[model samples]
Target: MKFTTATPTGAGPAAQFTGNVWFDVIVAGQEPSRVRVNTVRFAPGAHTFWHRHVLGQTLHVVAGVALVGTRDGVVFEAHPGETVVCPPGEEHWHGATPELFMQHLAIWETDGSDAPETTWLEEVTEEQYSAARTRSA
Candidate 1:
């Protein structure tokens, strides 16, 4: 067994997020592994740009309310301890609701080669952000 050093929290890139967001890399897999994990924190009104994973992605809410939106105008509201999964190549975006801060562990795997695990598209516009609504479970 081996202990991995911890990396300090870093700001999420402006190209990928709007408002205040931070992330700490928990696991950046090495050879023999293709998985990657990050603990992400989003301030109220903060969110990611539209993006998709090459393999897929899973998000486990750690605190506050999480609003996850998709291309088809569906938004999923996940509370603490809830897990949201995005299938491979599905365009989606997720972040904190406008009223509170939120945190989640973002989990996904690399394609295991040179291809990026995620492809980021345009940012979610004001109309999109305000249109978030809970879907029937």
Candidate 2:
């Protein structure tokens, strides 16, 4: 058995996210493995731009409330211990609620090709984020 080395926290780039966001890479698998995992933290009101994964993505919330928005104007409110899945090629964005800090484990897999695992689109507008949301039951 081997222990993995820890990586320093990285600030989510402005090109891909808005507000204050940070992440720690938990696993960036080697050649034989294509999985990737990260623990992401969002300050109040911080969130990622609209993006889609080639092989879909899963998010497991760890703290505060998380708001995940989709192209259909549906924002899903997820709390701690809740998990959300975004199917492959579905455009979506996720972040903390305006009043709270949030953190989640972002998990996805690469397609094993040279292509990027995720394609980022436009930033989520305030109107889109402020839309009414449905809480996860």
Provide TM-scores for the models. 0.97, 0.98
Quantify all predictions' global Cα lDDT against the true fold. 0.93, 0.96
Per-candidate Cα RMSD to the true structure, in Å, reads 1.0, 0.8
Segments of candidate 1 deviating more than 4 angstroms: none
- Candidate 1 clashes: the total is 0
* Clashing residue pairs for model 1: none
The C-alpha stretches of model 2 lying farther than 4 A from their native spots are none
lDDT of 2 by residue, 61-91 (tens): 9999999999999999999999999999999
Which candidate ranks first by TM-score, i.e. highest? 2
lDDT of 1 at 108: 97
Per-residue alpha-carbon lDDT of candidate 1 for residues 1-137, written as tens digits (9 for 90 to 100): 88999999999999999999999999998778888999999999999999999999999999999999989888889999899989999999999999999999999999778888899999999889889498434
